[model samples]
Target: MTARNNSFDEQAVLHELKQFLPALSPGKTFTYRNPLEGFQEQTFDDALRHASEMLGYRTTLSLEEYRSLYNSKRVKPGVLEKVLVEKKGAANTFEWQDKVLMKKFPAAAESPSKIGKLRANWQKQYKTDLDARVHPRLFRILGNYLDHGVSDWKFPVRGKGFLDSMREVESNSFVSAFNTPRARNLLLQASSSINDLLTVIVGDEMLFKQYLFDQQFAHRGWSGLVATLEIGREISPNGSNITLRELIVFELLLEIDVLDDRLGRHWEPLSYRLPAPPEDLFAPVPVGEKSEVLAIWQEAVEWSYYEAILAELRQDPQNTRNQTGTRVTETTFANAVDSLCIIGQPSLLRSVTAEHRAFRHGYDFSLDPNGEMLEEILEAVVPSLGVANLECFFARTGLAGMDDILTDQMIGLLGLADTARGDLQAPLPAGLTKDFEPMRLLCVVEQFPETVLEVIDRLAVQSTCVGRRSVGRRSIALWLLNEWVHLVVIDPVSRELRVLKNRKMITYKSAPRIVIEDAVH
Candidate 1:
């Protein structure tokens, strides 16, 4: 695969690419274009399988992963059986499903040469597994890229172009590295010579397009960067274009250039073979420290939405507070960057983002009648915060000092300040216990006031009979305050609470002050 003259038909390559690549406009005119846009002719499952074969992507879950989902009931075995029966019409679809479940699927296979060598050298030099040794920030960014769920924001690339902004991250950007005379000569040669690699990887234009689609979904950040940089080759209307096949070759050339520096290998044959490099290049930085490079990458990638929020906050000068705090100043930007750097885990970041969004929801609702500010605030907060803390997350925007109100009002309304003290417990029905944790109760009260009163009413009656009921009985007292009333609940057995509800039907919904007295006393 020696370097060829820059005489290859660029149009031919571009023409081949047009059959498969999706036309992606810049982030400014972003739309919900399907990642699988080119494969509209095939079913999702068939497209997944074909793309997996072409790009070495994981098209389906592995047996162990599927088994975990099945056991968790996320993917019910019964449902799979029924679907299989309908689709295959086999005599015993259950038997066929069981066989499919027992089989092991291969994990995505690694490519040859440069990438493989780098991974090997990394393991050999550091005595650390490359996959296990990613920097926290790098891992966080990668998690967000690969996240098929739980992430509300997807593939946010900002700036004049992907490579344009990526250059600002450090003194030496990929653009500068590849734009050098020597790098330029190599790119020209490789650009002209890409058809050879494409011929080996993709027989027809459709397969090449499918490979692009697969690669984009496989690591959208990198693919998106390539797409934006090579917009010149696009065949779409108005000079706008996306051609993933050429982008793959272009990105590979960049990787080869970088690898030439990293390993001091000419790696000229890589231009010929064009083995897929790892989706991203890392310095193989030490495993413990936060990755400043990855942080920079993430910041550049998400700068648009970040600045958009700052701009919107500037419009409303009176409101300086957001869920993440002050939005009108430089500190807000710094805090956003710091959050991106420090959050070690993606799940934790997601949790923090969710909590921050929820806080902004309540806070914005309190501040303005219109929901536009809320939407903007949420969009800004989406990038920061760890999702790891979501399991027990609560909104902390304007709810300051409310915990004290909740506790004191229950005692004041019930007139059981001396009797209940700290011993009262909320007795949940056996059927509802799984859904009735304290944080869940708080979430219900906070978000859905109309939906939670019945449950609260049941809890109130049980609080009244706690000490007198039996030797081993206990109850949980809950206090809720909405716009209308300060409601207190004592949770006990449903039957016992039902008797109280029937006994005090008169004051139940209207006068919370009297309702507490009749139900509890």
Candidate 2:
């Protein structure tokens, strides 16, 4: 096509785009890409397709007219037959600085008045009439459908009359509660159901399954969620397994802004097994006699709730310890940075933020209610960091291979203790098999070079050996002078000790202080 003709064609299509795609306001986006053959009137058709979907459009163009337009070679695929709409939600960049998110309130203001006012307003305006909203009802009914089974939805704007309704709730009752504030809690239970259904759906049918599939440990998250939702049938309706329902519940717990759970949450009412409260040592373990407890807690759940016990174990005096932790394991936190090095989860640990970070004589770890609270600390700190910062963590913890500042005694003692820990719980497949393993072992010395000397200075302790002996492990002491880690390790079988890591090579000129020498074994 000549440049002049191309200009004319472009102008004509641009005109049509304005007429057809009138719904694409600034900041709203819709997508349409056509895969037609050669010489297709690419621009006009793409614009037409873009405009069609704005107002409940499902088809781009009718067959007869489209054939005539394409037969004469007025359009071509991969040329102009791609539709772009405005992306939605939020204002533009430069409006907020990159570091704007880093700036948090000086302290959390727990203003009751504002919260009370918002609650009152919510009950009056939204809570009262939420049950009647069409979108909200769709969200809820969908959940019920998942938990109960809904291969046949007639899309009847009414309830109870649908096949799903006749089998579960009374049609009349469903019609009455279809779009009301009363059904909101049911919606919340449905998220797990949807999560389960979607995984099954994608797993069974999708072509490019790996990309979209949730591969979080055989979809354990979905399984856990489904287990929770199945209990909802007696509490919700027969089947209200939907994603929106879970979002409502998550939002409520996280203190995030979301639709009211009763409004759009999907759920299955509980008839058989209602979920019990979290079980763990965090729960009051009445000592004298084993009282008939209401229920049991998973081992992970049990261990997770022991932050107070952990704090006490550390011999805290001030009691100013923050004891809450989250569901983060060691491997997940470490893997967030580089795949080249893999750190398996010896135990679930809480993540620490700058606010909660602390240091003692031999090691550093927050006063978590449970012994491991790394997941919690990381949640707050991970977002405000560089990709490289992912591996950076509190270095003073008893974990070995994380740093080199600790003396061979401190390092060895930790490994032996960890070795004994194998008696408590078996070490996992990817987990490290240390003669003494370090608990909540964190090392960021290499990543955060500025703290290397400071950490070494703190490690200069006289009685670190006592704690090491108590734990059945020892620490290795060395310096990362120049660019090498000059260190030592003790052989478990020999009984007599030897050089840990003699000078093998020195490469990086940027780090010049390190020197390597042959130390006799």
- Give me the candidate number with maximum TM-score: 1
- Which portions of model 2 show Cα errors greater than 4 Å? 1-135, 138-166, 174-224, 227-490, 494-521
Query: How does each model score on lDDT?
Result: 0.30, 0.22
Clash number for every model?
Answer: 20, 97
Q: lDDT tens string, model 1, 1-521?
A: 33434444646645444333332232222222223333334433344334334333332333453344345433333334434554447686556454445544344335511122423433354343423322222323322333333334332433222222223332333434342354345544434455555343332332333333333333333334335335433222222233445445544444344444444543333234334433322122132111221121122222322323223222222222333554323211211211221111122122222212222223322333333342233222321122111111111101010111113223332233345443211111123222211111111011122223444444435422212222110112111211011121211111111101211211211101111111100
Residue ranges of candidate 1 with Cα displaced over 4 Å:
1-30, 56-81, 92-94, 101-181, 184-220, 225-268, 271-521
Predicted candidate 2 versus true structure: per-residue lDDT over 358-393, tens digit per residue: 221122232322312322222222222211221121
Estimated TM-score for each candidate: 0.30, 0.16
